[model samples]
Target: MRRSFRVLLCLAATAVGLTTLSAPANAAAHNYVALGDSYSSGVGTGGTYSGGGCKRSTNAYPQLWANTHAPASFNFAACSGATTTDVLNSQLGSLTARTTLVTISIGGNDAGFVDVITTCTLGSDSTCVNRVEQGKTFARNTLPARLDNVYSAIRQRSPSARVVVLGYPRFYKVPGSCNVGLSDTKRSAINSGADVLAQVTAQRAAAAGFTFVDIRGAWTGHEICSGDWWLNSLTWPVEESYHPNKNGQARGYLPALNAVTG
Candidate 1:
């Protein structure tokens, strides 16, 4: 009886040691890496980090999620004006085997979002509509393959990571009017561009086995023309125009990211 009791105690101690060893390994699996474009970088949201021209905001969704969840490690690699190629060339290095969570908002730049918005807002109505249609064409035709390459690279770099692809919110609230300078026709065109971006992004994300978070619905009543606008319109600093405001990051994006990642 005494020998049997001693053996049982030894086994229990060994089990406890094994559990202890595994705890940290499990925690380390929570390493997170954020990547993408101006939307992800929080360009128009007011704050900047490191001044490398990325304009990363403290209140961006990734940062907000990281602060709330307290992951084992967080790497913020999103940059303003980043296209699919930029992420492949510059940001993919941040991912590794241990990276378990990844979130990115991309493809807008590749679709010439900035250029489209600039042309639409400042040019003739016909010109604006034509530019927007061109953007949609790019999103449907060229953007997918570029996105596939980036997504594949990310998977290859961090095979274990759970990638979440976030899409843009529509800039204007439709069926309503505002004194924000954009004609109803121009607003419709720009919003159509946003829809195209979301659709293409969703398709690419699905193909890559990543979760695509569409912010359009969540941002429905809070678009640029709404009384409670989440997206900025033609701000003094031209760079600030068309991006999400700080409130948008906090209320709009943070909740969406949390829902998927949680």
Candidate 2:
């Protein structure tokens, strides 16, 4: 009877070891799909995958996360210039029942972000302020409903996946003393617009039962003109302006997403 008991104990210990060994394989098998706009696509991070028109960079947060985690499948479907409607039409196909993780940073385009920035950078201060206000109004009023639809679509497409909605960071550091061409007043206005965008995004994300990753605080002291700026200033390719640099992806956005996804 003693010998039989020892054999049984050995068998149980072996079984436990096998299970432990297999756990990593199971984790590595999860499907992760990234869906969003230019930020997620790594517009300013400066590298591109062939033939997506989305300008996806190898250093983008989603790619960075995937490289570290080694998910069984990784899909980058985020696009440059993608609005909420563009996502609904073009990006949703990437999600499926097998998807285990989804990360997105959108709604900037929907809020007329480019228009506001253009006005702020080139137009008069008063015009910049007025356009920024218009963008803010849209963010507060119309953006929520649009966000809900996209969130709902994601839920329907990937019922069991964990969805994380990442908010945009302010382009300027607070107390707005940046020398990035735009005046301090315009910088403040842009920062305020970022705040509104984050607020509305967080609300909608919660309402849809998704996690909202607020990047505002993480990006503090790392705006366009800061010594350790993670975002690009007005660059040669204009499109890269105001977008996160490679450091922002590797440091700023990557850690934020990891905290939630982990």
Measured by TM-score, the strongest candidate is 2
Model 1 bad stretches (over 4 Å)? 1-29
Model 2 lDDT, full chain set: 0.90
What is the lDDT for 39 in model 2?
Answer: 94
lDDT of each: 0.89, 0.90
Task: Put down candidate 2 lDDT per residue, 111-221, tens digits, no spaces.
Answer: 998899889988989999999999999999999999999999999999999899999998986565556678878888999999999999999999999999999889988
Local error of candidate 2 at 210, Å? 0.7
* Model 2 pairs whose backbones collide: none
Q: Write the per-residue lDDT of candidate 1 for residues 1-262, one digit (tens) a residue.
A: 9999999999999999999888643433489999999888887787556438877888788888888888899999999889999999999999999899999999999999989988987899999999999999999999999999999999999998999999999888776677877888999999999999899999999999999999999998999878799988988688888888888999999999988875
Off by over 4 Å in 2: 1-27, 176-178
RMSD of 2: 2.7
Candidate 1, poorest ten consecutive residues by summed lDDT:
21-30
